[model samples]
Target chain A: DVKVTQSSRYLVKRTGEKVFLECVQDMDHENMFWYRQDPGLGLRLIYFSYDVKMKEKGDIPEGYSVSREKKERFSLILESASTNQTSMYLCASSFEGYEQYFGPGTRLTVT
Target chain B: QQPVQSPQAVILREGEDAVINCSSSKALYSVHWYRQKHGEAPIFLMILLKGGEQKGHDKISASFNEKKQQSSLYLTASQLSYSGTYFCGTGVMEYGNKLVFGAGTILRVKS
Candidate 1:
């Protein structure tokens, strides 16, 4: 079975702090994505990488950055955490434009 | 642009039926559907790729209309396990691998 594992299931950070959320998928999929989900907003794409070292900005990419140095791992970084950034972050991997398999998600709270 | 989903929320009893619609303003290569239970990552339910093609998994089914750039998910004889937030992700040529999701439709099932 394909498994997408996240570094943390829950996290708390202070305002202005730099935070990193990691996601690793065992399926070796070519595409990896970072999304933030909030109540009523659904899942908004933050960023995505189709290949190692290649990244593209999604609709809601501000205040965030992503890294995909290796084929199996993708990272989401918050340059300066703020209270408004608190939400459930999800990582997903897919075979380029196909259906995606997702991680368990990390619920982050910024204070 | 993000697709618009109708019936923001719905309630259904076991064995009932429901439909969730997703419409996009831009032409699409495909429309993907996913289900996210409370506090969890979204899971791939199905994908509609061709115009007028309908597919089903278990009791859940979906249809795509290429001309209208719309898709609809049909849940027939709904089961308790079908309760969750249903999301439609649109695939646009300009967006590449990014799947911009809709606002989502929340579904609640009662025994």
Candidate 2:
């Protein structure tokens, strides 16, 4: 079975703080993605990486950046956290053109 | 663009059936379905790649209409364990491996 793990299950940060969410996948998938889930908004993509050092912006990439320095790990970075950035962050990895496997998710709270 | 889901929520008895629909304005290369229980990561349910193709496991099935850029998930003889939020993720050729997910349809099952 494929497994995706996130660095944190829940996190709290003050406004103007920097936050990082990490994800690792054991399946050696080529594509990794970051998404934020909010009520009535579903899962909106933040960023995605197809290969090491290759990144692409999804529909809602503002205030967020991603890093894919290695094939197994992907990280999402919030340069400066804000209250509006609080959300459930999900990381997913998949083979090109295949179903994505998601991590357990990190619920981030910004105060 | 994000896919639109119908019947934002639904309630069903143990033996009843329900259908959740997802529609997209753009052409779709594939349609993926996932079910996420409360406080858990979304789990991949099924993926429909061919136009007009129907696929399922157990009593849950899905159909993709490529021409109409839409897909529908069917749950028959639902069980308590089937209660969750159902999300449809649509993949477009132009979007590469990224999927645009719908807002989600919440399902509640009563014994």
- Candidate 2 has a DockQ of 0.90
- Candidate 2 CAPRI level: high
Model 1 C-alpha lDDT per residue in residues B25-107, reported as the tens digit of each score: 99998899999998778888998775544433665788888899999999999989999999999998877878889999999
Q: Per-candidate RMSD vs. true structure? A: 1.3, 1.1
User: Using lDDT as the measure, which candidate wins?
Assistant: 2
Q: What is the TM-score of chain A in candidate 2?
A: 0.99
lDDT of 1 by residue, A9-77 (tens): 999999999999999999989999999998899889999999999999988999999998999999999
Worst 10 residues of 1 chain B by lDDT: B50-59
List model 2 lDDT by residue over B1-111, tens digit each. Answer: 899999899999999999999999999988999999999999989889855554446668888888899899999999999999999999999989999999999999999
lDDT of 2 by residue, A56-99 (tens): 99999999999999999999999999999999999999999778
True contacts kept of each: 0.95, 0.85
lDDT of 1: 0.91
User: What ranges in model 2 sit over 4 Å off?
Assistant: B51-56
